[model samples]
Target: MNRQQKGWQQLFLFSLLPLFLAIFGASGWLWWNWAISPAQLNAAKPQQIQIPPGTATQQIGTKLEQAGLIRSKIAWDLLARYISSQKSNGGFQAGTYELSANQPLNEIAQTIWDGKVIQVSFTIPEGWSLRQMADYFQKEKGWFSSQDFIDAASQIDRKKYPWLPADIPFLEGFLFPETYQVTKERITPQAVVQLMLERFEKTALPVYQKSQNQELNQPKFTLKQWVTLASIVEKEAVVQKERPRIAGVFVSRLLKGMKLESDPTVEYAFGIRQTPDKPLTFAQVRKPSPYNTYATPGLPPTPIAAPALESLKAVLNPESTEYLFFVARYDGTHVFSRTLPEHEAAVVKIRRERQR
Candidate 1:
């Protein structure tokens, strides 16, 4: 070949090389911008999207893009691929997620991948005493001290809760029994108490007002007193259907000036329980204390436990009956009687069956 022709060919190749390099560099910059930049460049508000269970990573990217939470589906797909390559089992989780438009593609991918869901749950069972509720959190969750919870619940500002009674003696009957949720990291003893109290205010206030309008409360006793009675009934009634009946028996005894004779009140007054599910001793029953119904003429000064909705309603509208006494049967139910002789006979029958 001629020298002039070879020189021209070399110049042409060199010129093409710079053009290819410039094109490659521009492409690299664009890719980098897509990878690191927020999906919605000017988006300042947050958005919510639910990534359903078993959703593939590609679908998640598509959903995010469609929801305006992510900029590019290709970028998100690549980011998820990179994350999956780094971990043994890495993928988005199934949950309702709060994502912001300003969140970068990589950050969004990492959040769904880690499954940093935000809820912490705790349950207070029906008929759990304040102490029992405290003990439950301490023993099961290991979250806080029992006494701390008690103090926090009692000392919260009553003014903040207009529905809560001003003269409410303690937080015993007011901490409603229900499942509560809070931010996982923000779950504290005080937070739990506040949550429970708020739940009580929201749920119990209407019931309290209804009972008052119906004159369901005992004639001489105030709302708090009725609540106290309901608390006692709560601990005594093992079966759900028996709450109103048990409340009736107590009401009858109270009207006739008879001692309540409730074993749970004695246990609460003396703070003696061999086991959570055991019967009380004769000596424990006879112990003299203000809280002990056998020693006191009226309801205890304060509620002994957290009464559920059923217990509260039972006190407001007790079953009308002539029964004045009751004894526990083998099936964790009570056998009611109108007279001492009938009660004794029922007790004997229960004892014989238990012995058998």
Candidate 2:
């Protein structure tokens, strides 16, 4: 071959050699880390991994490896350094980091830079017991057990809660229903229950003050007594529009020295797992428990469940009426009555409809 041609060929070969080497090296490195490396950890979507504040670069890499974000801490650090990237050292941040192995390295780094965290929210329904609320977290959020929540609440004496049930154990209806914003980390069943209880107090305490004002006029109602009655009304009226009327019914029943034959009392007594649409049998209704209205005349020891704002308002501003009986129609509204004859007629209608 001519000298000029040979020179040109050599230059072309040298240039191609560097290009091939770079491609092969990068491919080898990617394979070795992503697939050829030791056992890797997988990240589920929406799973948050925490990165503590002010974490060093080495520590960040170590955490990423530990969290299964990358195969090796050294490998990630080396790559970060190799790319002439400004975010050298750890190149990632700390403080509850959420990343996935499936995400590209650049994206994962950006996630760290963005300081993403997982937030969980709990919406406690009206009249839910502390135990039930705890179970909700365990089942829904994988937080903890109902028993653990009960144990924590049990440490706080209900007796200290002046507006709570006199013969009760721990917090129950006092946990108000509301939407809560909670962090995934440092979140326990106890914390959520405590927050609900705090909210309940905020709502109930003002009503207690009004009851005190009534006592000033006639000296009959006490704060604790008022809350006890309010809780009964809270569970009885499933419909917001009928809450005040239902509260009036309960008040009328109390004043007339009649039995507060509330089925929610029995249903609540059954607890979170066993509530049913059907009413208790005569034998079941006659069960010997302080909670059984058929057997005992007074208010149940504690509220059946957490009360909503409207239910609380029903107790506070009860409609002035003579309603003494109420029955659920099961369409979320109720059948209310005043006289015994009216109540029986309503009951008969309900029973016939139920049979159908």
Question: Could you tell me every candidate's TM-score relative to the true structure?
Answer: 0.68, 0.66
lDDT of candidate 1 over 36-57, digit per residue (tens): 4353556667666777788988
Q: Candidate 1: worst 10 consecutive residues by lDDT? A: 32-41
Off by over 4 Å in 2: 1-47, 52-95, 99-116, 157-167, 210-223, 270-277
Please give the range of 10 consecutive residues that has the lowest summed lDDT in model 2: 35-44
Per-residue CA lDDT of candidate 2, range 51-106, in tens? 77777766777777776667667666665555437645443545565556666665
Q: How far is candidate 2 from the true structure (C-alpha RMSD, Å)?
A: 7.7
Model 2 scores what on Cα lDDT? 0.68
